[model samples]
Target: MSTAVDTGGASDLTLRKEAVTASADNAPTAPEPAVGATRKEPPPEKPSDTRRRSWVVASFWIIVLFLGLPIWWHTTSIYRANLPLDRMLEWSDGKACRPVFPLRISLDPGSLQDQEAENLLRLTQHALDDLNDFPAHHLRLQLAQKEAKQGSDVALTIRLTPGESVHTATSSLHPHLPILDVSYPPNSIPTPMSSSSGLATYIAAQLRSNFAEEQNIINYLLESSTAHQEQRSKSVSQDVAQTLSKRVTRSLKYARTYHLTFSLFTNGPSPSSWDIESAIDQYMRPVLDMLAPIHNFTLDTQVQLYAAPGVQSQVLSKEDLSAFINAAEWPLSPSIGGAPTVNFVVYIGNQTIGTEAAETSQSWLIPQWGSVYLLAPPSSVHVASDTLKQPILTFTSHLLSLLGTPQSGSLPLRLSTLTRVRSADLLLRASSSLGSLARLSLALKSISIPSSVADGVAKSMHHLELACASLGNPESLEHAQIAEAEAERAFFEKSMVGQLYFPDEHKIAVYLPLLGPVGVPLVMGLLNELKAWRNRRRQKAKAA
Candidate 1:
C-alpha cells in the first residue's frame, strides 16, 4: 500500500485487498481488483547504492591522514635545535678530558753546561715525581730555549744562581715576571752520576710547597664538578675539601668586570659624605689597576643619611648582623651593565658591635660583595674626608675577605690565590650550569632549544677546555670567567624560559566551527555504511 501527498497533483493513490465467500468443503477466494484504485508491489529492493557514499567517506579520511595530520604535526611540534648532546654529555661525563694542568717549568741556567743543567733538571724532576701524590697538577721541568725570552718560557723560572750562604735554599718571585729565584750554595751543584742531589731535592720540595694551594683548589673543583657514578679522585681530604669549598663559595663567580660600590651610611645627617674619590685613588687605585689584567673594576660611592639598622639597640647581636644593612631602604642597586656588583658600605652609626662590646666600633664582611664598617665618629662633629681614614682602612680589610682573599698570606700571595680560587670557582659553576641545562632540557620535553643556546654551550665548553688546560695561569682565569658567564647565559636564556601558555578552550574554539559540519557528515555516513554492510554479511552467513 502507498499513500502520497502530491503538490504537483499528478500522483496516483492505490489500495489492494482480497474478499472471501464461505463454501462448506472449500472456501472460494475472490479478489477485488481495480474498481476505483490499483495495487502495485514492484520488487524486493535492489542492493542499496550505499557503497558510493562509503567511498566518499573513505576518501575524506585518506586526505586527512595523508595531508592534514602532517600539517598539524609540523605546526605543533617544538623546535629542538640540534645540540651536540653526545659531546656535551661527554664533557659532563668527564670522559672527554682528564683535566690535567701540566705546567711546564723551563730551566734557564745562564752559564751552566747543558749536561749539568740537564742532570739537575732530571734529578729534580725525579724527586718531584716521587714526592708528588697529586699528578693532576704537576711541574714538568724542561730546558728553556733562549728564543722564548719574549714569551712565557715556563710558568715560573727557577734561576740556579750561586749564593754565598751555606747549603740553604732561598726562593724569591720576580716582581714584574714569573721568574722564581732559587739561590743554591756555590758547591752544591749535583754531579752527573748522583740520583739524589741535595739541591734537586730542595728545589722539588720548595716548588711543591709553592703550588700546594693551587693543586688543592683544582682538586676541589674536579671533585665537585658533576654527580657522576664514580667519585672524582680526592687530592684533598674531606675536611680540607669542605674548607676549600666554603672559601670558594664565599668567592664571587668569575666576571670580566666587577663594579665596586663604596657607600657611606650614617645614622644621622651630620656626616653626609666623604672624599671617597680621592681616598680610593690614593689607597685602592693602584691595586685596581694591577687587577686590570684579571678583572675590570668600576668604582662608585654614595652617602646614605637618616638610616636605622634593623636592630635599634646600641649593641648589635649576632643575629642582628644580617639585618643591619637595611637593604630595603638602601640605594645599593647593582650598577646597570654587564659586570657583577661588589658593594662596600661604611656604616656610620653609634651602634656597638657585640664581639667588641668594650669598643663601640667594628665592621663585618658581606662575603663576595663588600664589607660594612660601623664607625661612630666624634659626637657633635661632622666626619670630614680625613675622618674616614679608619673606616676606609677597615673597609679595605673587609674588602679583601669579601673578594676571596686568603686569611693567612702576604698581599701578593692572597691576590695570586684569589686568581686560582676564582678560576676553580668559575669552572665548577660552569659545570654545574651545564648539568642544570641538561636536566632542564630533559625535563621539559616540549620546550624548544634555540640554536643560540646550543652555540653558547659549545662556546662555554670550548672555554672550559681551555681553562682546564691552563689551570693555575692568568689566562685560565680569563677562560673560566668567560665559560661561566656564557653558561649562565645559556642556562637562563631569556627567550628560552618565557612561558608561552595557550589555553585548551582557546584551541577548541579555533578548530570547532571548521571541523564540526565536515565531521558530522563523515561520522554519520561511516555509521550508516557499517550498519548496511553488517546486515548484508548476516544475510550471507545465514544463506551459507
Candidate 2:
C-alpha cells in the first residue's frame, strides 16, 4: 500500500510539472522596453533652408523668364526687315503705270511753201486721227522746219515731191533711216484752207499700214500685262495671240548687251580655222549697227576640233537636232559679262536631216540661246567667207528674232519696234517680280527679310516710278532695266532661304539636355516647399 501511494504521488507531480512547463512555453509575454530607443521622424527643416530653397526656385524661374528665354529668342528669331508690302502689291497690279505711245511723224514738204506745208500737215493729222482706232498708238504730224535736224524725235519723215504721173502717189521707206519717202502729184498737194485731198488720205492710210503691226504688238503686250481688264485690247485674235505667245517665248530676255559666240565645230581636226570675223562683218554688221541704239553686241569666235555630236546617227531627225550640241564636251560657256550669250554653232558634219518635210532647213534657231547650222565638210583646211555667208545670214535673222524684233518690217522699223517692245516687256517683268516678292513675303511667315532685300525693293520701286512716268520714251527702257534687275535681286535673296532648313526639332535637340536637368530640380524644390507650407498650416489649424 505504501509503495502504490508513493508511485501515484510521483506520477501526479510529474504531470503537474509537464503541464506548467508547456503552459509557460505557449503563453504570450510582454517585451521589455529598450533603453535610449524612440520612434523615428523626419528632421525639422530650418526656416533658412526653406527660404534658401524657395529662393533657389524663384531665382531659376526669374532667370528663365528674364535671361534664358530672352537669349533663346534672340538666337533663334529671324531678322525681318520692314518692307512696303502694300506698295509692292499696288505696283504689281499695274495701277501705278499706264503705257501710252505718242508717235510723232514729221512731214517734209520739199518744194511747197510754209503755208502749203502747214495745211498738208494739218490735213494729214486730221486724217490719221480719224483712221486710228487705237488711241494708244496714234501719229501726230508736224511740218519739218528748214532748221530742223536730220534725225530728230520724228518716227518717220515723209518727203513730198512732184511725180511724173498725176494723181499717182508712191511711198517708200528709207533703207537706213526712219524716213518714209513719198512722191505725190503737184496737183494732189493740199493747198491752204483745203479740208481733204487724195495725197493727205493716201499718206494717212500708208502710215497706218506701216505701223499696224507695231500697234498690234504693243496692244498684245498691254493685254498680256497685269493691267486692268478694260485696258486690254480685244483686237487680237486667238491665232494672233498664239503666234505672239510663241514669239515671246522664243525671244530672249531683254538685256543691254548680247554676247554673240560664233563657234566652228568640226568632227576632225582638218578644217579647224574659219573666216568668221570677216563673214560677220559682211553679213551681220549692218543689222547689228542698226540694233546699236537698242542693244550692244560683243563678238567672240572659237574653233573646236574633234567635237562629237550628242547623237551617233548619220541622219538626224527634228527631235535629234536639239541634242546635237554636245554641251558637256563643248567649251561653250557664256561670256564673262552681264550680257546673255547667243551661240551660233556651225557644226561641220555630213549628217543630213532625215525629215521628209520640204519646209525644214539645214539651219535651225534654238529659242533664247541661238541658231545651229549643219554645214557640209569644207574641201580645204580653212573655211572661206563665201562658205559661211549663208550661215551668217541665218544667224543675223535669228538674232533679230532673239532680240524680240517684229517679224514683218524693214530693219530700221523692226529695230524701232524692238525698243518699244523691250521697254514694255521690262516694265511688265519688273511688276510681276514685285508681285512675286510680295506674295512670297506673305506666304512664308518664317522667312527672314534681309536689309539688302528691303533696299533693293526700295530702289526697284523708285526706278519703276521713273519708268512709269516715261513709258513711251527711250529713257523708260533704261529705268525699266534697272527696275527689273533690282526686283529680281530682291525676290531671289539668298539669306531668306537659309533659315528654311533649320527645324524646331534641331533647336530642341540643342537646348533640351541643359534645360531638362536644371528644370527638374527647380520644379521639385518649388513643389516640396508648397507641400511643407500646407502641412504647417494644417498642423497650426489642428492645434488651434
Candidate 3:
C-alpha cells in the first residue's frame, strides 16, 4: 500500500510540473526592452554651473568688446588731421584770386606848366584806357614832382622835351635806365580847356606798343595753366601763342637764387686750367649786377681733362648736338643750397657743328638746362681770360634767355616783367600742389595725415592770400615763394606715404596670431551656452 501511494504522489508531482510548464507556455511574455530604452541618463546640470558657464562666455566677449578692441583701435588707428578742403579746391579753380597788374607811369613835363601837364596827363590816360583791351594790365599816369626823386613805386619815367617841329611827337627808350624819352612840339601840350592833345595820343600809342609783348606773354601763361584757362581772354594769336609757349617751356623754373657752373671739357689733356674767374668778372659781372634786383647768382668753375663727349664724329649734326653731353661721364652734379644750376660747358675739340642752325654754328643753348660752346682746339694748355671772352659773352646771353627775360623790352623793363611772371608762376604752382594734396586725401582714406600737414596747409593758405593781395608789387614774389614751399612740404609729408604700404592684408598678418586662439574658445563657449539656454526654454515650455 506504501509503494502504491508513493507512485501516486510522484505521478501527481509530474502532472503538476507539466501543468506549470503548460501555463508558462500559454501566458504572454513581456517584450524584450528596445535598444537603448533602458540606458542610464546623465545627471542634469546644476543651475549655478549653467549660469557660471554663461558668465564665462559673456566675460570673454565683454573683455574683447570693451578692453581688447579699444586697445587695438588706439594702437592701430591712423591719426588724420582735418584740412580746409573747400578752400583748396577754390584756389585751384582760380575762383579765389584774379591777378591784376597796375603799372604806375610817371609823367615828367619838363617845360610845360602844371595846368597844361595835368590836362595832358588826363587826356593821355583816357587814350591809354581806350586803347588797352587787356583788363588785367592797367597804365596809370602820375605827375612827377621836380623836387621828389624817382620812387620805387614808379615802373617807368616819361621825360618830355620840346621838339623843333610843331604838332609832332617822338618816343625813345633809355638803354640803361627805365626811362621813356618823349620829344614833342611846344603846341602839342593840351591846354586846360582842351579835351585832347596829339602828344598825349602819341604817348599812349607808344606805351601800348611797349607793353604789348608783356601782355601777350601773361595771356599765354593764363591760357596754359589748367586753373586759369577759363579766366584767360584768348588775346594771343596762334603763332604768337606758339612762340610764347616755346619761350615758357624753354625757361628754367624761377627760384630765389641760381648757381652758374662754367665747365671746360677737353677731348685731349692739354687745356687743364682756364681763367674762368677773370673772364666771368670781365664779361658777366655787369649783367649779374643788373640782375641782382631780380635774381642772385652764385658762380663756380671746373676743368675736366681727357673727357670724351657722347658724340665722336668730327662734324656733329643737329641731332648729334642734342646727345653731345656725356651725362654719365660729366661731373655736373648740381650745387647744394637748393638753387637751380645753369651749366655752361666749353668743349675744346676739333669737332664743328655741321648744320647752320639760327642759335649758332659754334654754340647752342640747351633750354632750361644750360648752354654748350665748341671752341676750336686751344693752342695753350692754360686758357687766358681773352680767350674766354666770347664764351663768357655767350654764357651771359644764354643766362638771360634761361631767366625768361622778355625779348622785346629793355633790360630793366624785362627784369620787371620777369618778376611779375615768376610771381604768377609760383602762385599757380602752389595752387595746383594744394589741389593735388586735397585729391590725394580724398582718394586715400587709409593715409595718415599729421598735424604738421594741416599746419603747413594753413601757412600756405595764409601766404597765398598775402600773395594775391600783393600781385602787382615785389612783395608778391616773396609771398608766392613761401606759399609754394609750404605747399610742397605739405604735399610730400613722409608720414602720409607710409600708411599706403600697410594694407589690410598686412594688418591681418599682424593681428591674426594674437586674436585667433583667444577668439576660437570664446566663440565656441558662447555657441554652447546659447544651445543650452534654448533647450532649457523648450523643456520648461513642455512642462508648462
Candidate 4:
C-alpha cells in the first residue's frame, strides 16, 4: 500500500513539472528569446590609412612648430633695440670725461716796463699755483697790450698803477667791468731776477679770495655727481654742502630760455593799474641783458584786481608763506614753450610775517619757481615805477638765484661762474639720465624698446661727447643742452613705458583661453604618437 502511494506522488510531481515547462515554452515563444542584435566586428585599419592619420597629426605638429610657434613668438616678443649700455654706464661713472676750467687772466702793467711786468706776472702765477689746491681750475696769466676789451674770454684784467707809498698795495674791483685796479708801491714791483715778491703774494691771495666761493661751488657739484668722485675737493665743508643743497633745491633747472611773468595781485579794486612795463624796463632790463648770453627772458605783466591771498591771516607764518600764492585762482600758468616760467607776484596787502628772521622778509624767493613781494596798499590807483623798484630789485636778485648763479663775486664774475656751473650741471644731469635709463632697461626685461629710444640714446651720447670735449666753454652749454634734451626724451619714451604696463601675466591672461584648448590636443596627440612609436620599435626589436 505505501509503495503505491509513493508512485502516485512521483507521477503527480512529473505532471506538475511538465505543466510548468510547457507554460514557459508556450509564452509566445518569447519572440525566439529576443536574440540580441549581433555586433558587427570592425574592419581592420589599412596601413595607408594609419600612415595618413599619422601624417596628418605630424603635419599639424610641424605647422605648429615651424609656422604657428614662430608667429606667436614674433608677435609676443619684446622689441629691444640695441643700446650702448656699457658706453652709457662708462659716461655716468665719469670714466669718459674730466672737466677742467682754464680761466685766463689778463694783466695790464700800466707804466711798468715789459720786463718788470713779465716778472710780476711770473711771480703771481707761481704764487697762485702754490695757493690753489684744485688743479682743475687753473688761472693763466697773459699781458693785455690794449685797453681791456669788454666781454672778452679773459676772466679778469689786473691793471697795475704806481703809487707813492712804498711796500703798500691796494686793490679794487671795477664796478661795471671785470677789471681789478691794483695800486702798488714802486718798491713792491718785482725785479726781473726776483723769485718772489710781497705784491705777487698779495695779488694771489686776493684772487684766491675772489674765487673761493666758485671753487667751493664747483667742488660741491663734483661731489654731488656720480662721476668725478676722486676729483671732489676736501675744502667743501658740511656747512657749505648743506647750504648748497638748500640752494640747489631752491634753484630752477637749467634752460635756454625763461619766461618772466610779473603779476600785480590786489584784494581790492584800487591799484589795478601798475607801471610794470616801465619798472621792468628800468630795473630788470639790465640784468636780463646781462643774462642774454646764458638765457633769454620773456616778460609779461598782468594786473588782477579781485585776487585773494591763499592765507587770510594778516600775519603769515613760515608755513603760511608757502601757501600765500593762490595758484588755483591766479593766472600763473607756465608759458607755452620749452622754456620754464618764473613768476614774480607783487601782492598789494598789509600782511606782515610772523617771524622777524632775515628769511621772513616782505619779499621771499620761492626757490625754483620764482619770488613773491608783500607790498603795502599803494597810495594811488596807478602804481609808479619807483614804488615797484624795491620789488623789481628783489625779483632781480631772485632771478639770479633761479638761474643758478653763484652767490658771491661781482655780477660779471658771477655770470662767468654761472656758465661753468650750468655746464657741469647739465653734464651731470645727462649722465644721471643715461644711468637711469640703463638701469630701467635692465630692470624691466620685457619692456619694448622702440627704435626712437635707441636713436635718442645715440643722439644723447653724441651730444654728451661733444659737451664733454668742450667743457668750460660756451659751446659746451649748447652741446649739454642738446644732450640733456635727448637723454630726457629717451628716458621718457612713450612706447617703452607703455610696454611696461602689459606684463607677462597680462599677455598670458589674454592668450591662455585660446591657446589652452588648442594646445592640449596637439600636445597629447604628439606625445601618444611618440609613445606608440617607441612601443612599436620595442616590439619589432623583440620579434627580430
Candidate 5:
C-alpha cells in the first residue's frame, strides 16, 4: 500500500516536472550571440576619397596661407620708407659739418691811399690770426669798394681817416650802422714792407675786443653741445661760461616770426588807455626794423583794468618776481599764429622792486617769456608817449635779451651777431632732432616711417648742408630755419605716434579669435592624416 502511494506521488511529481518542462519550453528564451560571425571590418577608404580629403585640407590651408595671410599682412603692414640713417648720424655727430664762421670785415680807405689801406688790412689780418684762439670763428679783412653799397654782405666796414693831431689810432663805432670809424696819425700808417704797425695792432685789438663777447658765447654753445664738445675751445672761463649759460637759458628759441603783445595791467580801474602805439613806433620800431631781416614781428596791444598779479608784495624778492605774472587772470593769450608770442606788461601799481633783487628798479625781465614793468600810479588815466618812454625803452632792451642778442657792441653789431648765433643754434637743434629720429627708427622696429618723413629728413639734410656751407652768411639762417623745421616735422610725425599707440598686444587681441578656431581643426586634420599615413606604411612593411 505504501509502494502504491509512493508510485502515485512519484507519478504526480513526474507530471509536475513535465508540466514545468513544457512551461519552460513555452517561455521566451534569450537570443544567443553567433560565435563564428564576428564584427565585419570596414572597407578601406577609396583613393578618390583620400585624394578629395587631401585636396580639401590643402585648399583650406592654401586659402589661409595665400589669401587670408596675404590680406592680413597687406592690411596690417607698416609702410617703412628708407631713411639716410648713416648721414643723419653723421650730421648729429658733427662729422658731416664743421661750422666755420668767416666774418668778412670790409676796410674802407676814407682819407688814406688804397695801398696804405691794403697794407694796414694785411697787417691787421695777420695780427688777428695770431691773436685768435678759436679756429672756427675767424675774422677776415677785405678791401671795401670805393663806394660801399647798402645791404652789403660784409659784416662790418672799417673806415680809416688820417688825423693830423691824433698821436695814436683810435676807433669809434657808428651808433646806428655796422661801421667802425678809425682815426690814425699819418706816422701810424702801415707800410707795405713793415711786418707790424701800431694802427694795425690797435685795429686788431679793437676788432678782437668788439667780437670778444660773441666769441665767448659761441664757444660756450659749442662746449655745451654734445656734437661739438670735442671741438669746443678751452679758453672760455667758468664765470663766462656760467654767464653764457644763463643768457642762453634766458633767451627765447629761434623763430621766423615773433608776436609782441604789449599789455597794460592795472590793479585798479585807471590808466585804461595808453599811447603804446606811438611809444612802440618811437622806441621799438628801429630795433624791429633791424630785426626784420632775421625775424618778422607783429605788434598788438591790450589794456586790462582791475587786474591783480600772482604776487601782491610791494617790494618783490627774486622769487616773487618769477611768480608776478598772473597767467590765469591776465588776458595774455598767445597770438593766433605759428610764431611764438612775447609779452611786455606794464603794471601800473604801487609795487616797488627791491634794489638787490632786480638789476633795475623799474622793470624785471622774464626769461624766454617777456618783461614786466612796475609803474607808480600815473598822474593821468590816459598815459602819454612821453610817460611811456622809459617803460618802452625798457621793453626794447628786454626784447633784445629775449631775442638772444649779445650784450656788447652797438645795436647793428649785436643784430649781426644774433644772426650768426641763431644760425648755429638752429643747426645744432636740427642735427639733434635728426639723431633722435634715427635712434627712434632703429629702436622701434614697429614704427612706420612714412614717405613724408623720409622726404622731410632729406630736405632737412639738404638745408643743413647748405647752411653749413654758408655758416656766417645771412642766407645760412634761412637754411638752418628750414632744416630745423623739417627735422622737427620728421621727428614729431603724427602717423608715427598714431601707429605706436597701436601696440603688439592690441594686434594679438584683434587677430587671436580669428586664428584660434581655424588653426585647431587644420592642425588636427594634418595630425590625423600623418598618423594614417604612418600606420599604412607600417602595415605595408609588415605585409612585405
Candidate 6:
C-alpha cells in the first residue's frame, strides 16, 4: 500500500497536459482482454441464424404436404368402388358353387289304390335310376299330396285304366296338357313289396325316348363348360355333330319375347294380301298363347308388291340362298329391348328351285332364325286367306324349330323341353361371361372398373342363384333371363374398362414435366444442408 505523490516538474511538461482529447473512436467494439490475454474464441453462432435455416426446410415441407401432394393425388387417382373381387373370381372359377340339375317328376295316384300307386312309383324310380348315367341330372319322383297337386306334380300322368291288351301306351299332347295313357292288364300291376317289374321298364324306356334329345343337348352344354374336367365325350361324330351344331348355331338364343314378321312378297301385283292377320290369328295365335308360359311372341304382318328376288336364274345354288334374302333391301330389323327377331317370308314367285318341286323346294329353313316359303304366283285376284293355308302351316312348323324345340316330341312336350333348354343355355352363357370378365380384368391391369360393374355382378349373381334354385321350371327361364341380362351388363359395363389411354410413356411424360424439375432442386438442397450440418457436428466433436 504505497501512497501516490504528484511532484511539479518543468513548466513546459506541465503546460502540454492542458486537456486530453478522447482516444480515436472505436476500431471495432470488442470486449477488452486482460493483459497478456490469449486469442479470443469466435463468438458462438447466433440462435436466430439456426432458426432461419430450419424455417426454410420447414416451409418446403409445408408446400409439399398442403399443395403439391394434394394436387397430384387429385389428378392421378382413379374412382374405384369397393368390389367383391375375390367373390367374383371365385364364381368365375366355379369355386363358389357347383351347378347341379335336379328335375322334379310327380307321381299322380289319380285312379289307383294307394299301395299299388306307391309300388308303381318305386319301381319306375328304380328303372329310371338304372337308365340314368349322370347323377347331376337326377329325376326326383314325389307323390302328389292332393288331387290338384297331382295335376301339377308329374310332368305327365298315366290314367292306369284297365284294358283288353296286356299293355298299351298312348300319349295326348294337344291344346291343353301333358298326359300319357298307359293301359295294362289288371294282373300286371306291381306288388307292394316288389322293387322291379316289367311295367316299370316300359314306362322308363318310353320316358327316356321322349326326352333323349333334351338330355343330349344338356350333356353337350355341360361338356363344353369348364365346370367339369373329365366328363366330356364326343358322343356324336363331325357329320352328325355338324347337323346338331347347325341346329344350335343357327337357332336364336332363348328370349322372353320373339318378334314374328309374316311378309308376302310378289314379283307382280297379283297377290297383295293373303288374309295373313286372320290366318295367323286362327292358326298361330293359339300356339303362341300356349307358349306364353315360356315365351311371349309379337306378331306383325306385311304385304309388299314389286318385290324381286335377289337371284334371277331358274335354279338356285347353295351360294344363291344367302343373296336371296335381299338383306340390303329387306325391312326385317331386329326387335327392340334385347329380344331377337324372326322373319318368315312367303314370296309369290313363278320360279322353282333345284329342278325338283317336292324336295323342300316350296319352303326352306333359314338356319336357326326363320323360313322362306316360295308360293306359286297366285291367280290375279285380290288375295284371300285360303290361299295362305299352306305357307302359314309351314311357317308354324318352322317357328318350333327356330325356337330350338326338340325334334322327337309332341308340341306340349317340346315346349316344356324348350324351357329347360333355354334355362341351361342362359346359365352356361352367364357363367362363361363371368369367366371372361375375370380374365379381362386380370389381363388389363391399367383398365379401370366402375362401381356399376360391381353392382351388375351382384345383381347377376343374385339372379343366377334364384335361377339355379328353380331349374327345370318356367320360372327358371325368367330368372335365367334376368341373370343373362345382368351378366351382359356387367361384362359390357361402359365405364368399367376406360379405353387404356395412359400408356407407360404417357405416364412418364406427365410426371417428368412437374416432378422431375421440382424434385431435383429440393433433393439437392436437402443433401447440401445435411452435409453442412454433418460437417459442423464433426468439427464440434473434434474440438471437444
Model 1 C-alpha lDDT per residue in residues 1-544, reported as the tens digit of each score: 9997665433222211112222333665688586878577877555554566667778988888889889989987777777766666666666755555667777878678889899999999999999887756667998878776724325667777878798586877676555677888877888888878998999898888777776676666766665432433454688887887787667775667788888877777777557778777766776676666667777777877887777788788777888887778888958658778888877776777776445544777766777777777655445665666766777667656556666643455556667777776777677778877887787676678888899999999999999988876778888988889888999888777873354456769998998899889878877887897898899899999
Residue range 240-307, candidate 3, lDDT tens digits: 98898888889998888999899999988889999999999999998899988778898888899988
What is the C-alpha local distance difference test score of each model?
Answer: 0.74, 0.84, 0.88, 0.86, 0.88, 0.74
**Residue-level error in angstroms, candidate 5, position 480:** 0.9
Tens digits of per-residue lDDT for model 5, 114-150: 7887888889999999888886788999888775484
Best by TM-score: 5
* Model 2 lDDT at residue 15: 100
**Least well predicted 10-residue stretch by lDDT in candidate 3:** 1-10
RMSD of each: 10.0, 6.0, 5.8, 6.2, 4.1, 10.7
Tens-digit lDDT track for model 2 on 1-544? 3553457888999999999999999999999889999888899888898788778878878988999889989997888899998899887887777666777788888988888888888888889888988756758888776796955356777888888878589988887788888988878877686889788899999999998888788788878774544465565888888888899899998889888889999999879799988998899998888788778989888898999999888778889988888889999957658779999999998877776764445788899899999899989999999999999999988988888889875777767777777877888889889988988889878889999999999999999889877765677789999999999999888887676687677878988997899889878887887898899889889999
Per-residue lDDT of candidate 6, residues 309-380 (tens digit): 899876676677878887766676577565688889988886556634444366778876689988787676
Residue 30 local lDDT, model 6: 80
- Residue pairs clashing in model 4 are none
Model 1 quality (TM-score)? 0.78
> What TM-score fits each model?
0.78, 0.82, 0.88, 0.88, 0.90, 0.83
Off by over 4 Å in 5: 1-41, 148-151, 164-167, 357-360, 501-506
Sliding window of 10 residues with minimal summed lDDT for model 1:
12-21
